[model samples]
Target: MRGLMSAGLLAMAFTLSGCGAQPESHEAHEAPEHGAAAEDYERGPHRGRMLRDGNFAIEVTIFEDGAEPEFRLYAYRDDKPIAPADVRIALELKRLGGEVDRFAFRPEGDVLRGNGIVREPHSFDVTVTASEGGRRHRWSYASYEGRTTIAAAAAAAGGVRSERAGPATIDERIDMSGRIEITPEGKAEVRAWYPGRVLAMRAQLGDRVAKGQALARVESSHSLQSYTIPAPIGGIIVEKNANVGAMTGDRPLFVVADPAMLHAEFFVYPRDAERIRVGQAVALRSLSGAARLQASVEAILPTADLASQTLLAHVHLPASAAEQFRPGMGVEGSFVVAVQPVPLAVRTRAIQRFRDFEVVYAKSGNSYEVRMLDIGRRTPEWTEILGGLKPGTEYVTDGAFLIRADIEKSGASHDH
Candidate 1:
C-alpha cells in the first residue's frame, strides 16, 4: 500500500513539473518575435536589423532642443563597440513610429553612456535594438530624461562639449590642407611683350643668363627683318613653350625671372580669408611637416575667386630659398594675423579635441591635465592660444594621436 501511494505521489509531482516547464520554454520561444523588425531591416542596406544581446547594447543622450540629432545604437563585442568596417553596419536607418531613434555612444571604461531625445519635450522614448548572426533584440525606456537631464549628466561630468556649455580652451587651431603654386612677389612676364617668330632660340629651363642677354632673335613685323631683344633683368629661364620652330601668339611663350626672388602661392578656402593680411609675417613650411622654408606675407587679394571661391595670398621667399623652391611645389604656411603680443606657441600634434572644444594635455605638477583653450593662430608646427591656457605648456606633441584616437573611438561617432 505504501508503494502504491508513492507511485501516485510521483505522478502528481511529474504533472506539476510539466506545467512550470512549458511557460519558460514558451517565453523563450516568443522572445524573438521581431518579424516586423526583421522586415524593417530587410529594407536597409545588407538588410540590416535592430538587435540586442550580452555582447551589444544601444544608448542615447540628448542635450539641446534645436541641435542636430546626436544619438546612436552600438554593436559591442567583448564589452567594446565594433567599428563599421569590421562589422556589417547599415548606412541607412529607418524609424517605424518616427520616435525610436539611434544615438551616439560615449564610452567610459567598460560601460557606454549616451543621450536620447524626446521630441515631445520632458517625455520621450528610448529604443535599443541590434542584430547579430541573423537574430534581433530590442528594449526601450519611456521615462528617460529630456535635454535637461542630459545637460545635467554632462554638467556632472564637467560639460557636454562647447565653450558656453562646457569646459573650453583658448586655442582654436586645426590642421587643415593647403596647396602650392607660383608666387608673384618677384615675377616677370615673358610675353610676345612684342610679337615675333622663333629664331635662333637657345633658352631652356634652369639656364642661367645675364641681364641684356639675347633670348631669341626674331624677324620683327615692324622691321620685317631679324632683330635682337635682350632680357631686361638677370635671371633664369624658368618656363619656355617656344622651341626652335614654335609659333608665338599673344600668349606668354617664355617665363624668365631671378630664381632668388621666388614666392609660394597657396590656394586656400575662404574660411581663412579673415586670418591673413598683406604685411604680416608668416612661416612657410614643407607638407612633409617640417619647418624647412621660411617666408612672409607680401600680398593678399582684396577679392577672391567667385566660382572656385579660393583666397589668393602671396608669400615672399627668402634669398636662401633660391633655385630650390620650384613652382607647383606643395607647401603650408602659418600666418599670424592677430597676436596676443608675444604669446607662447607649441606643435599642433600636442593638442587634442574634446567634443566641440580644443584641448591640450598639459604636464602640470607631475600630472597630465587635459586643458581646454580658445585656440588663437595656428601653423602645422604650433598652435596659438588666447585664453584658458599658458605658453610653453609641456605636453606630448609626438604621441597625442593615440589620445585623440581614443576619444573618437570612445565617442563612437561615424566621423571618427
Candidate 2:
C-alpha cells in the first residue's frame, strides 16, 4: 500500500509538470515540413545546411577545425540518425572559373566520410548525391563568399596598412638612351670683325665671362685701329684660341657655354619617332646612375641618322641640374608618351591572388575581409581599381600575404 501510494504521487507530479513546460518554438515545428527552416540553415549540428530528400535529410559541412578542411556529412531519417553503412554519398563542386571537382564517400565508423580533403575556400555550386536501399537522392547548394578575420595586433605586426582610395596620375613612359649637349641658344663664339692682330687678351680658358665682357682686343690690319671683342653670352670660356699679338683671321677668339640651360638629345628609333612629341616630361639619368635630371621634350629633329635610322629629340634640362651635367655625357631618358588619371588606385603590394580571383584584404577595425577586385590599368608602383574598392576606404598596403596565408591556413582558400 505504501509503494502504491508513492507511485500515485509520482504520477500526479508528472501530470502537474506538463502544465509548466515551455512549448516548442514555431521554427522547430516548421523545419522538417519546409526542409530546414531559414534561421536554421547554417545552425545544424555541423554548422552547415541540411538538404532534405523525401523523409531523409543530410547536413553538409566543411570541417576545418585546426586541420585540413574536409567535407563531413550527417545523415538522418524521420528525425533519427541513420547508420553510415546504409548510405553511399558523393559530392561534386563546380567553381566560378569553370573548374569542377568530385569527391566520393564511404562508411567510416558512425558517419559517411570523404575519401580526400575538400579544396578551400569552399565557394562553389555543390551537388550531393546519396544512395540508400537501391534508391538515389540528389541536392545542390552554393557557399563561401570568401571572408575571414584577423587580430588587430597581428595585422599591425604583419605590416598591414590601409587608406582611402583616391585619384592618381599615371604617366606612360618610353625609355631610350640619350646624351647631354649644349643648347644652341646657350652657346656663343666670339670672333674678330675683320682680319687683325690680337693686341691683348683679357680672358683665358676656364674663365667665367659675362655677356658684353671683353675677351680680346684686336688691331685691324686695314684701319690699324684696336677693337674689343665681347663675349656674346655669360658663361665659362670653354675654348680660347687668342694669344697676345696673335693674328686673327676667320677663327673665333673664344667659345662661351652657359650650362644653366642644356639639352638632352634622345636618339629614338624610327619606329618610336612617331610617338615622340614636344612638351612632354622626361626623366634623364646618367649611365653611372649618379646623376638624375627632369626635363621636357623641346624639339624633334626631322632628319633621321642615316647609319642608325634614329631620330633626335632634344629635351631641355632644368637649371637645377645644370652644375651636374656636361656636354657629351651619356645618359638615358624616359619620355612621357601618355598620361592618364585614375579615380581609384592602390599600391600594387595590396593585390594578391586568392583562389580564382585577384583580391585585396579590406580591413574593418579588428577584422579583415577578402575583397575581390576588378582591375584595370597598372603602373610599376600602383594599380587602378575599377571595382571591389571604394574611395576614402583603407586597405592592406603591405604584408598582405601574411593575412592571406593566415586565412588560407584557416581553410579559407575556397579554391577548388
Candidate 3:
C-alpha cells in the first residue's frame, strides 16, 4: 500500500509540473561530450539534444506546447530523416534522492514519443538507449535544474534550517478585548461599628495594608469611648472617605481591594456568546504586550450589559500576576474554542509562491527542491497538507525564501 501511494504521489508531482508557466531553461548541469566544448554541439531542425555516433543519430526534445511535457525523439541516418517506426528508444532518469523514472517510446507521426511526463526540478542523470536495424546504441548525460548545494557553514550563516514534515494541532481561537478588575469577593468595605467621629486616620489612599491593621481611630458618640477601626481585608486602599476629624455615619470609611485577586471581564457579543463557556482556556496579554499569562474562564455572567448588550466572561488571574497587571488595565485575549489535529502539516511561514503553485523547499543532503502542496485548513502557525508531499520528507521550515531566491538568481529554467 505504501509503495502504491508513493507511486501515485510521484505521478501527481510530475503532472503538477505542467500546470504552471514553464521557465526559460530547465537544464542546470549538462555532461560534456569527450574531446569537444560542451556548448559546441550539432543541432537538428527540432532544436533538441542531438546525439550522434557516426552514421546513426537521434534528436531528443521535450514537447510541451499547450500540453503536458513528454519526450519527442526524431531519428536520422547519415543526417537524413528516418522513419520513426524503424527505431525503438528507452530512457532512465535518476533523480537527486536516487529515485529513478523510466520511459519507453512508441512511434507517433515522425517522432517516437515517450509514455511519461518529465517531472520538474529536472535535475537528474539521464541514460538513453536505442535499437535500430538490429544494431544497439547508448548514451548518458547530466541535466539539472532548481537545485543548489551550499556548504553547511554557508547554510547556517544564511539562516536556513530544515525539519521533517509531520502532524500538528491547530488552535482555533476567538479574539476578545476586556479589562482587569478585582473579583467581587476580593473587595471589602471598612466602616466604623457605630456612628462615630473619626479621631485619627492611620492609613491614606493608595496605601497597602494587612487585614486587621489599624486604618482609623474612631470615638463612638453613644459610649464616648475611642476604638480602632482595622482594615476588613489585606489589600490596597482604593477609596478613603474619612479624614482625621470627620464624623462617620452610613458611608464606608475605606474601600479595600485586593489587586492580587483579579479577573479579566471579557465582553462577548450575542454572535460569539454561544461559543464561550466556563473553563475554556484563554491567553491574556496586556495592552502593551509586555505582560502575558494563561488562565481559564471561571464564570459567564447570565445577564448582558444594558448599554452594550454583551455578556461577560470572567477569567481569574493568579496572585503572581499582580506584579505586572493592575485593576482597570485593558487586556487582549485569545480564547481557544477548538483544536484540530491534522496528519501532515507545515509551518505557514515556510510556504512561498512558486510560479502558479504554493511550495516549500524540500531538502535532501545539501540540495533543495520545490514541493507543491494541496492545502486544507490553515492557521497563523500551521497549514494542513492534503496532497503533493510525502511523510517524513525534510523541508525548509525557516529561510525558505533564501532558497527560492538562489534558484531564481541562477535563472534555472523549468523547461524540459
Task: Write model 2 residue lDDT over 1-416, tens digit each, in one string.
Answer: 00111221221100001000111211212101111123434345656567777778787767677987787788888857889888888888774444588898877776677778765434455678888888788766544334334455544544557775678877788899988888899898899998989899999899998898888888999999999888888999999877898899677888899878688888999888888999988888899889986788999999988999999999988777777888889998888898899898888778898777888876656545566788888765578888866686667787677666555544432322
Model 1 spans > 4 angstroms off: 1-180, 185-199, 221-224, 243-253, 341-416
Give the Cα error of residue 147 in candidate 1, in Å: 44
Q: Pick the candidate with the highest lDDT.
A: 3
After best superposition, candidate 1 residue 241: deviation in angstroms? 4.0
lDDT of each: 0.46, 0.70, 0.78
Candidate 3 colliding pairs: 25-413, 28-144
Instruction: Give a tens-digit lDDT track for model 3, residues 11-125.
Output: 1101111111121122323432211222344557787777776688888788888997788999999989999999989988887677899999999898898999876555567
Give the TM-score comparing model 1 with the true structure, all chains together. Answer: 0.40
TM-score of decoy 2: 0.57
Error of 1 at 208 (Å): 1.9
Tens-digit lDDT string for candidate 1 (1-416): 00111221221100000000111110122211101111222111112222344555332223343774333334556645555333332221222123233454454443333444323212222334444566565553222110111122222232112211122222233222455544454456565535667676767788877877878776666666776667666777877777665556765656777767667776657787776667776666677765466566777776778997987777777777755566566877666665443355555666776555677655322222345577666655556666655444455454344334433432212110
* Candidate 1 worst ten-residue window by lDDT: 11-20
Ranking by TM-score: 3, 2, 1
If scored against the real structure, what TM-score would every candidate get?
0.40, 0.57, 0.74
**Better candidate by lDDT, 1 or 3:** 3
Model 2 stretches with alpha carbons more than 4 Å out: 1-161, 166-169, 288-294, 341-343, 348-363, 366-376, 385-393, 396-416
